[model samples]
Each structure stands twice: as C-alpha cells, then as structure tokens.
Target: MSNTTNFKNLAPKGLRIIEQTDSLYHYARVISNTRFGYQPVSVAYCKDASHVQYCVKFCSQNNKAFRIRSGGHQHEGMCSGNGVIIIDLSEMNKIEYIDNQPNQAWIPVGKQLDSVYTELEKEKQIIPGGGCQSVNVGGLTQGGGWGYSIRKFGMTCDSILAAEIVLANGTIEIVSEENQPELFWALKGGGGGNFGVVTRFKFQLSALTDYVTTFGLTWKHPEDVKEVIRVWMNLHASTEVELDPALSSSCTMILANPDEKDLDCDGIRELEEGQKSFVDGRMGGQFYGTKTDLIKLLKKCFGEDLIPEDSKFTLLKEVCYASKKKSLAKSEKETHASLARHQSILANFLNPTSTPEQEIRATNECKHRNYRVLPVAPTSTCDQPHPHKVSSSFPKKYTCDDNSEMTERIYDFLSKCCYYGDVSKYMSFHCLGGAVKKNVDKRVFAFSDKPYLLQIQGWWDDISNAFDNQSRNDEYVKWVKDFRLNIAPFTEGSFINFVDQSLVDHPETHEGLLELLEIYYGENNLSRLRKIKAEQDPNELFKFKMSIPPLIE
Candidate 1:
C-alpha cells in the first residue's frame, strides 16, 4: 500500500489528514514566525485522546518523525518543522468542570487563553496566564506562564493540579504529585514538546474579584527614560512604597522612530502628531481593587508631578463610568462632572487618541457577566502573523546604586537602536514576586525568586516578503541580539517560554543543546528532567530541536 493509504488506514474514523496536495496544507504550515520555511509532510488533526493515540502509534510503528502543535505560538517555530508529520490538537479544545469541584476545571491543552478566560469568567474564576490571548494552555503552563496577576496569584503552571498525557509508546497516563511523581514534577514548567504530548490539564482556579482597575502611565520624554525605569523598579520591589499584594505591573520601553510616518508591526504609528516623538516608556497592569485605591497608590508612588491631581480625578471618574458602577453619589459626579474633559486627560497621558466611545466599547466587550475584567492594552494579535524574534532573562533585584547603572544601559539601547521597516522594538519587564516565591521545590520551574522577567522582542510586518530583502531581516534580528548582549551581565537565566534558537546556533558561541537546557531549567532541575525523559520516552520518539534527551544509563 502507498504511504497515504497506510496513514489513512491507521487514522481513526473522522480524523482529518491534510496532505501537501490539499489546499489547507499551506495554512497548516504557517506558524508565528513565517520567516522559517517549515514544510510539514502532512497534518493530522486530532479531535480527542483516541485520535492522538492512533497518530502516535502510527508514527512510532512507521518510523516517521512528528511534531506536536497546540497553538503554534512557539517563538522559534519548533512546534512545526520541515518534512515532519504534524499532530495538531487545535480541534481537541474543550473545557470541562467536574461535579462538586468548584475550585478546579479540566482544560484541554489546545484551548487558547482568551477562550479559557471567557469560560472561567462564567464561574467567577481565573488562572494566572499570559497577556497574549492566542497562547494555548499547553505551552504556556508547561513553560511557567507569566501574566498581569502573576505577583498575586503566581504562574499558570503553579495552578496545574494534574495533566493527562500520551507517551511515545501510545500509553495514556494521568500525572500528578501522587502518580508518577517524577514525571509529574517534570511536566510542570519543564518546557513543552519534551517528554510527551499533554492533552488536557486539570487547573486549580482562583476566585475572580468583582471589579479590577487597570492603569497605564507613560513617560514621553527621552531624557526621563532613566527616571521612569528607576521608579518602576522601585515600585515593583515595594522599596519606595509599600504596595498591595493584589497589584502586579510591567514596564516597557520602545525604541524611538527615525520617521514619524513609519508604522509599527501592530500597524499603529509610534510617534503621533501631538505626542512626544521620543523614546516612549509605559508602566501598566491590573489591580484587583477599586479605582479610588489604585489612584491613591499611583499618586503616592509616581508623585503628583508625573500624575497631576487633575489627571487622577479624571481617571477615577472615567473608570467608574466604564465599569458601569452606580455607587458614585450624584454630588460626587457633579463635583467631577466633565466626561469629555476626563477622556481628553486620559487620552493625553494613558492611551493616546482614545475617545470616550472607544473606551466604552472596549470595556463592554471585556465585561464578563456582571464583573468587569479589564485586559491590559495592546490586546490580542493572533489573527495577524508576523516575523519576530525574542530573547528573555530573569534579573534579580539591584540596589539603588546598581539600578542607576542598569537603567543607563537600557536607556542607551532604546535611544540608539536602528529601526527597520515597519519593525517594532522594545524591552518588557514583567514583575515577579508575592506568591511566586512560595513554592520553590515542587516543580522544575527555576527563577521563581527573581524579581522580574525581561524580554527583548522585535516584530516586523510583510512576512510574505521577509526573505526578498535579506538585509532588512538581518538588521532587525541583529538589533535584538545586540540588546541581549548589552544586558547579559545584569541578567542571569533565560525563560524557557521565550525560547531563542540563537543561543544554541550562534556562530560565536556554538553552545551545545545541554548548555541551552542549563540556561532554561538550571543544572539541578535539568538532571532530574532528563531522567524522567528517559523513563517516559526511551526511544526519543517525541523530539524537537530544543527537546530534552533521555539520560544515558
């Protein structure tokens, strides 16, 4: 029989197999980074655990290489590769709640963050997850997911109660602390596509608050970039001000644009007409509290000079209206009555060019039942595929004197980096603390005690024409590489979720796979992870470029 006939015979009934001849095969091959020409032989769309088992068996018996794809959001495109069979779980997404289990739910690995968030909101529950809505629970949880609520609730992996996985031998196993303890520990924050294919996760959910206050503050002047970083770092550490544990924030600094008309990868111009046309810095996050309390906290931390008294009152009234709260007294409304004035002040400081109508529409869309869940701005870009590269590091807290030097280095890069066509370059710092420091020995996720995670990211449009101009791609790629090098001394370990291929493939270092693994899981955790890999996948059937290898006996 032919290869196609053999695959069809082994596949379960109703399992869709998209071959290279099929029209949808091209679409199946596209990942987050379209720059790498990954051409999979065929894509097997698995709908359930049975379908996954059959595909794994076929690949094992036929000696065919395969890669597992949940959301295809892997930074380096390791989820799909050239000439490999793709086992896609996009069709297997489903959320199930157990009887009498109010604090937990079973989430299929293929479910994206947006869908999970919407479904969990129905029960007034949440799981600490990443900002990008398209990132699926499988990869995010496996790589120690970070989010705006990270400081309060900890990572997505920390919430995992158990997981159902299919081993290379086509055996299904439920892994938890009691069952297969080593494998269970490895599954939590040991990186995706390593040992087995995780089909579903039983997550321990947290109670969602009735209301949340989301705030954004920007420093427009290039000269104030250092001060912005210093203050933001102090705020994250709670050194200058005693912050509430319910608050979590991130700071981002964007490279200045050479031309005013150059659009970013999001198709928005960084330098607006009336806005300050310089290196822009923004600090924003979600606060599980009322608008009144958030305003008080910000004013105390940032001072009245940066956050004027008038602007604070305007923000308070705007959030009250957006949330549709009726608690504001009529006399208080009359005291701060100008709605247009509130929106104008917010537009000037927080979100540029935002009107009252736009704010209301966005707020209404994010509303779940009666509760208000405000997502941080720059919402989901899942539909738009672009070429991008990211490198990350978890830096420890520095003293005031040390912070000054680090701030200067970061400011220099943001001010001097070259901008390519339609490329957006920035550095993001996600604060880490509070509950993240509670459980250090339960999982393989390292760097939980670190202060924050920093990501050096670059994205550009026109993915179809990326290869036509090699120099443009090189310039953008080199910019991120150089920035990573500049901050190498201050940073320690890298985040596995933000995997970078250059760490192993760079010409200067030529670091081995083991060295790259050390950077992600540390030396001690990596040793245990390899042993579990040996137990689960002895033949290395489920392997990728950055996957863990079986320990040699």
Candidate 2:
C-alpha cells in the first residue's frame, strides 16, 4: 500500500489512473456499499484490451494483488479489496455487431446490462441476462447470467461464442470451443476474477420479440400468500403440469414492513396502526407471447378462481400503439386499461414517492412509440448503491404438499425476521429447468438440474448508518446467513453469481476452499476448473479469498 507513487508512472499512456491523492479516487474506489470502506492503492480505468494488458503486466511485475472490476456489482465485493490495485473496466464500454452474421456481437466486458439491452434492442436482438441493469457483462456471464428469458434462450454464458482474455502472463488469447477449449469452458460460469481479465465477449445473440407480455400479481393475505407460492412452485416443478417453455417466472415473498403502505388503483392506503406482521408474496414474470395467450396460459396454470382480480399485466407492444387509432375492440380497450394499471403499479413498485403525474406521463409516452421499447426501466432498482447481503442456491424440486415442514420453516423465518430490524428482506424463487438444463454437459454452470434458484436478500438504505451501527448491520447480515442456513436442507449447490464471503469464513458449512468450490461448482466441475486454472494462471496472480486456485503440482 505504501508504494503508491510507482503506480502513476506504471499506467500506460492514455490510461486514466486514480491514486489515493486524486480527487476522484474515493468515487472510483467504492463500487458497492458492502465494499464502501475498501481503500484501494489505485484504480486503473482501462479503455481497451491493451490498457488491460498494461495493468495486468504492472501488477505482475510489482507482485501486487489486483481485483478486476467490470460492473462492480459482486454481492460480497470480492471484485475489490482493501489496499490493492483495482483494474476498472467501466471505460471499455462498447458493442460491435458482426456485419453479415447479425446474430453475433462482440460486447466489451465493461458494458452494463442497460446499455447492452438498449443497443441490442435497436438491432432486434438480445442475450439472456439478469434483470439488474447496472450489472456488467463480465461478471454476469462468467457467473451464468439468469433472466426472465432464460427459460426460452438459456443463460448468458450459454450464448458466449468466444472471449478475449488477458492471462496472468499479460498475454492475450481469444478462447472458444475451437481454440483453447478448456479455458473457454472454465470461463463459462466459473466465477469472475478466478481465471484472468476478460476484455470482451463474442456472444451468440437471440432474436428479440416485439410483443412479449409481462405480468405481476400480489397476494397480501397470509393464506393467499402461501397458496400463491405453493401454486407458483408447483407450476415450475410439478411433472403433471405441462408448463410452457416460453414462460419464465419468479416469486418473491417479502416480510411485511410496518412503514410500508399499500398502493392500489385507488391510491396509497396506510396499514392499520398495530397490524400484525405477515409475509407478502408476489409472483410475476415475462411471457414471450401476446396478452391473450398469456391470459390463457395463466388460467390453465392457476385456474380461473385462483387468478387474482387485481393482477397487473401488459404487452411490450402496447407501448407502441398509436393513440389515434380509429376504433378499438372491447378486449383491446381492456388491454390498454391494463397497460395503464401496469405503469402505475411499476412506478410505485420502484418508487413509492412517484407522483400521479409521473405515472400518467410514463403511460402516455409509451402510446406513440413506433419501435419496441422496454416498458419498465431496468435500472430503477440498481441506479443507486445500497448496503445489501445476498446468498443464493439452487433448490431441489419439491411439490407443495410434500414439503409442508420446509414451507413452514421458511415462513417462520420470514415472519420472525421482520421484528429484528428495518432492513428490507425477501426470498426470491427464480424458476429454472427449461432451457437451463438443456445443454448442461457442454458448460461448466452447475445446478441446472435444480428446479429453481432461491436468493435470500437483505438491503439497508443508509450507508452511514450501516458503517456506524455495527449491531444494526450485523442484524441484517445475520438475518441473511440464518435464513440461508434454515433452507440448507432444501438446496443442493450455491450459485457463484451470488457469491458470499461468509461461506468461506464459516467452518460448519464449508471446511475450506475445496468444500467452497464443491458448493459453487460441484465436485467434477471443480476439478476441471482447477486444472484449467493451473494451465492458464499457474502463478495464481488472479486470486482472491474465494477465487479458484491452481491445482498444486
């Protein structure tokens, strides 16, 4: 940490370097609230592959540990560390589509999800990616990106045709199935910052549809919450129900917040002063079809009576409808009304303080659109950084009736945790097992065989409060850890994308790096990854607390 002066001259010409003395150092250093206090020696903002190579070479020569950062959204903040150099890739944001092959594109590792989605939508194409817009393609694809369209097209890593990586030796290599196949395989879902610095990814893109339907349904009542969760899980895991591959959904069960108010078509309705605490469950996702077809599919899955009356649904194409259209059928009018309702709900869902005027403007702007535009702003939730702790796992398949004890335990944890602190807490069940499990043998991403991905999350808004109040922050972190432990019996393997540092710290759950690797990559895949790590980065220059180390010779 003391040799800070050497970094200034080590940075290549045209590369921007922010040392501790620089005014922008603080801003460049902290990416996530969890890593707010991590003070890096310097942050090198690499613009392209050459700059990345220079930074890698600098770190190698100085024998200084450096962390690779793209979107900087790593849950545990391993993308950064205290008193080390950070090779920041945010400046290398660019996308180049292949001329004749419209279905393929080379995206820089620094490109965030929002820009990627917006750029691809212009070409009527998209890659399967997570919902968080600020997440960079580097870490996301490396950890096996999951999104609403995953059930249709598979993971983001699955679409990776090739990658341009700077190895530990400062040598650049473009890896793919046809070249450096083992390294390429390891790149897919092997976890980021494990192997080397990935400069860009050559992705095999999928055609983007114009009229996909997105829906949201909330069940506030306790009995209704349990019933919705039961039905949703059954829809994904039940062999008796022939669920469509075109539909991908997730359910979130949130512990009731005393400060939260209910907002409906009427407006905000305050909760009763001393209302008993309960869990609120919401199930919703996108369908690659029209509203009419989506309604039919939902009815088939939930039955007519089970479908909530106030459920919100809308078509992506509805945003492109011309306001001056001559005549509308009764069904079309209902669909428009539904779109309006959806906008209202979405605005409030993202920001409760959103004014009625903002809601109307959001809906009205959508009416005159000509091209396909994303209905909801993908960056709404992730625009600002907050202190959060998350742990994820692939849950084993279980029917509603067969897992009564597990269900009760999950509910019990959710209900009891609300009284501990004011942090926002929820468990999200992301449906899997459609295209996710199709070609598992060809990729390193493990746990596709599991029915769904369960993420236990806790978020705190005030960074100052989080750092100052140790006990308060501990309550939030402990809640996530305790909840994850409660459901350990029902889950198989951990998701590398939602990496947790505590897994390595805890002795009971994992003995050491080997056990942690097994939890993240499975036994067989872990061995393969270790061998590849040895071959590509034998020196272990790219290493962290949870990073995969080279196999001992």
Candidate 3:
C-alpha cells in the first residue's frame, strides 16, 4: 500500500487531521513550545501508544524524520527537530493503582508528574519523583528521576519495578528484571526515547511519611550572602539532619528585591554587623519562610551581627524555637542521616573560597548580561561517578588516603565560579558518591552516579536576545562544555536529565553516554543493546541526536 494510504487507514477513526490551515500551526505549537530551541517538523497527538506505533510506522514508510514527545520537560528537547514527525504521547493520560496494598501503581506515559502525585495521594501513597510536577514519568523515570525524596530514598528509576514499551516494529513488550533484563538495565538511566516508546511504568510506591517542609531564603548584601552560603556549605558537610533542604546554590542578579520593602531597623543593623569583618558593607537579607532546622542553621551561619532591620526574624525564630521545643520530647534515637552519607562534602568545605563576594557579583553580572553562567563543584558532592575522566571521587581511593590533589582539583572547579577571576555561576546540585551512589545499583541508574548535576542557564526575557548570533550562543555553550571537560578526570558520569541540548553537537562531553551504557549493561551486554537497536530499528528511524549513539568501533 502507498505510504499516504497506510497513514489514512492507521489513524484512529475519530482522530482529526488538520492538513490545511491548522496543520502547520499544530506542528508549530509543539516545536516552539519546547524548553530547548530544537525546532519540530510536525506533531501528532496520539490517543495511545498504539497511535504512537501508527505514527512511527507511517513516518518510517515515508522515510521521514521522527521524534517522540511525553510532556516536554527535557532541558534538551530530544522530541523536536526541523522536519521530524513528533509522536506526542500527551493524550495517553491514564493512571491506575495496580496494587494499593503493596503500594504499586501503573501510570501511562502521558500523565504529568503533578497529576500522578495528586491521583496517587488519594490512595495514601506516592511515587519517588522530581520537583517539576508537569514532567512525564516515561522520560523522567527512564533518565533516573531525582527530587524532594532523593536524599531520603533514591531516584525514580530505583523505584521502578517494570515497564511496557512498544518496539520500533510496533510490537509491544513488557520489560523488567525477569523479562528482557538487559533491556531493563539499559532503559534505566540510559536516557529515554532511545530504546523504545514506553507506554506505562510500574512504580514501586512507598508510604508517604512526614509533611514536606519547604522554605526560601534571600540575601541582598554580597558579604552577608557569602557568609550565609559559606555557613550552609560547612554545616551541610558535617551535620546529618533528618530533614533535607534542597539548597539553591546558584548566583542571582535581582532586578527587583521582594524583601527590600520589608526591611526595617533591626534587620539592617544585624546585616551591617555581619558584614563588619568583610570589607564590603552588608545591606539586607531575609528568609521567605522557615522549615525544620534551616532557620537555626542560617542564624548560626550568618551570626546575629549581620541581621537586617525590620526583618522577619521574629516569625522565623518563633517557628524554629517552637519546633526545637517540640523535638525535646522525642528520643535521640529518632535520628536522621547526616552529611556523612556522601562520600565527600567538598562543596560545603570549599564554599567560602569558591563563592566569595567578587565571583558572586560576576555571576550576578552574567545574569544581568543574560550570559549563561555554568556551575562547577567538587566531584565528592555527586551520588555516582562524574562524566569527567581525570579525577574521580567514586570507587573511593582507600589506598591513596591523602586526597589533597583531588581536593585541589575540586577547589579549582569551584574557583571557576567562586573565586575572584573568571568565576562562572551556572547552577549544579550534588548527585555523586553519596549514600545514593553506594546504596543504589549504578547499573540501573548510572547517570546519577556522576559527581555533579548542573543547570547551565542564561536568563533573558527577550526571545530575540538568546540566539541573536549563533556564534555567541555557541561560545557560551562551548565554555560550559569546556568546564565539563576540565572536570572529566575527576568526575566519571553526567546526569542526562540535566543535559543542555545546545551542547549536543560536542561529542566528547557526551562520552558519559557511552560510560552510562557500560555501567548499566556492562561491556559484555553492550552487544545485546546494539543488536536490539539494529533489529528493532533497522533504519534507525526513531533515533534522536542525543539518544542512543551508535556504539563506536
């Protein structure tokens, strides 16, 4: 049958095709809407994975480029391209609790993270996942999701017990540890939309215990801000707290300060006193809210001298003071895990040196100029091995006890952003060589093993300003890649979920993708992955630029 005829017959009976006026607009919508700048050729909203198979088959027969979409949350939009047929799985939103008693749930590919969380909460259970509620389980789980529960439990990939996927040839297969185990290994943390189109995920749900505590703290004075960060890094490194605060360690240039109006006499005096030691005079600072022991820690870090006038200290103190009062009744045996769970706490130790005043300002300037400030940190902060090859923190060096060289290497990376000269303030989080690394199976979520999960962002309200010139954009991306490359010796892996698409053209940095495969499937099992990719996708029709790269010779 003709390709056109096949597509017509394959589409769902009630499915509408707008080829005339709305056709281009429909495709354009998915393309321009992606977080990454990747352009899309066309888009088809599938009613189910069966519809996805039909779209794939149709694109295959026509020799057209294609991409898959499941709640486009990937920082790098692998689901979009110039002339690709986008199989949007947004319509396949069905979530079912398979076993409520055992805390097992089956979720379709299209359902957003928030929807899943809401639905699952009704059953008094929750799946371990990321913060972005709109993200799809298919992509997030495949990439080894990490969120609020990351420090407490592990990742979304670790909790996954099984999955149902549609192969390239339109055959549906259930993959798990028992069935097609090798594929299962590759699927977890291998990056999604590569092996096959996932339809549903079987998540191992856990009992939702304790109320999630959240708060935001802000600092205006450079010196006080530095002090706040310095103290946070040091405290987090040494102290083991039951409550984990997902700290935002990125630099910011505040055009408008929300706390500026609220500041009064006492708050200003405290902040000024805190800045007395530093050459720069302290101005103001405030906490948006308070949670757990975070307030006390902040106070201890900055000291009372640096507090601002008319600040919200009374409320903060009241909460912390009350919480501590309540905790006195409990036993010391109800202990929480500490910073020791991580292999290294260099981020905290080197916090003072890396994030000093001048670099912070420069990073803030980068934000002002809308240039991407890349975040760099110690490999010890990561959960697994970093993608970097030269100096690694994972597979702890028991033999070489003196880690001064490794420490220096980390300081240098931190210095790139924290120090006085050429400091970049791109954001990154700890994801390597910690409890998550030692406890979880790296083969299942190898990407998380990397020392750092970075978010290289350039904030600009103007759409025309981002890529005004491709060369400038290229330079910014290359600089971030260079930062990653420089750390390759220390870090042995990279987080795929945090990958920035602008750097996809650079193959060397992406070497982590290959390393990820090795960690999961092992050298022996790689042949099987290649064979499956070849057999299921002979034309390599379903492949994305950053998905599964052909195994090199």
Considering TM-score, which of the candidate structures 1 and 3 is the better prediction for this target?
Answer: 1
lDDT of 3 by residue, 480-541 (tens): 56655555554443356665433323444557655544543445545555665665566576
Q: Write the per-residue lDDT of candidate 2 for residues 476-497, one digit (tens) a residue.
A: 7888889988888887678888
What TM-score, over all chains together, does every model reach?
0.83, 0.85, 0.64
Best-first order by TM-score: 2, 1, 3
Q: How many pairs collide in each candidate, listed in order? A: 0, 0, 48
Q: How accurate is candidate 2 locally (lDDT)?
A: 0.72
Candidate 3 segments exceeding 4 Å error: 1-9, 14-28, 31-41, 99-102, 221-425, 430-435, 447-452, 462-492, 501-539, 550-553
Error of 3 at 440 (Å): 3.2
Off by over 4 Å in 2: 1-3, 258-276, 309-381, 419-421, 462-468, 504-511
Q: How high is the CA lDDT of each candidate model? A: 0.71, 0.72, 0.48
Q: Model 1 residue 528 lDDT?
A: 87
Question: Lowest-lDDT window of 10 residues in candidate 3?
Answer: 384-393
lDDT, ranked from best to worst:
2, 1, 3
